[model samples]
Target: MTMKILISDPNKCNGCRMCRTACAIRKAGVCNPEKSRIQVIQMDECDRYLPLVCQNCEDAPCIAACPKEAISRMDDPVLQTVIDYNKCVGCKMCLNACSFGAIGFDEDRGRPFKCDLCGGDPLCVHFCEPGALTLKDSAMIQYDQARTSALRRTVGIRR
Candidate 1:
């Protein structure tokens, strides 16, 4: 079986933000949306709701941007790359490097946090009742960049 990557269908989303709540709980052990690795953005004017999370790029820009070598991938069962807050310097370079705007800052903790696929099974995927957020086979991960570019052209959304 192929490893999977998270995908969001803005058209299917209803802006309930359950994914964000679940992400926060799994990643931070809290119920705070602000602490969530995933985020839900509601474009009220356009009537679109987008759930954004780390893309886990093959050539992860976040990993390259971290001067501290704070980010690394887990290669055994899951290939998800994650941040090591201990090595992070709170400089926010990785935050700037992420084009998808998936990396999030913990204001109180002063470190960058992003989706780690919940160590294998993402809580956000489990809690996404609308089916807006789902995991697709990793083969599509490379194509997502081009697809997202096309989506951006259609919707004019930066994220």
Candidate 2:
């Protein structure tokens, strides 16, 4: 089985954003959501908060979209996708390819960063007290996603 995968419960999420803060601290050594691998988007009209993170897709398009060969995934005991910033040209191609908008910019290095799942122990899960975020099985996540998709249709922009 794949490693623990991050899941977001939009119904329980109120856009509190403690997950983002925790992620930022764990990854960046400071509290900066801009540098955090995980991000949250708040929809006031819909009264929802959407947490975005790297999905570690089996067929990750971001890996293919990177012309510099900067993005790649390891298929060993744990499935992990890593980005070589030294090789990344910051073309934002991966950003465009990611459907979840999980990719974020690093102003200091001029490179793109994304969730590496805190090296397997996600701090976001520890910080999310309301149970809005948790690490779940990949298979269960897929089933939940399929059901969620069938529940509603995308009417506006695909992005």
User: Where's the lowest-lDDT run of ten residues in candidate 2?
Assistant: 150-159
CA deviation > 4 Å runs, candidate 1: 139-159
Model 2, residue 38: what's the lDDT? 84
Residue 60's C-alpha lDDT in candidate 2? 90
Predictions in order: lDDT: 0.84, 0.82
Candidate 1 vs. true structure, TM-score? 0.77
- Model 1 residue 150 lDDT? 90
Across 1-159, the per-residue lDDT of candidate 2 in tens digits comes to 646678788888888888989888888898887778888888678879888898788789999999999998877424477888789998989999998898888878788988877766788888888898887767787888776776655543232
TM-scores for all predictions: 0.77, 0.80
Q: Give the clashing pairs for model 2.
A: none
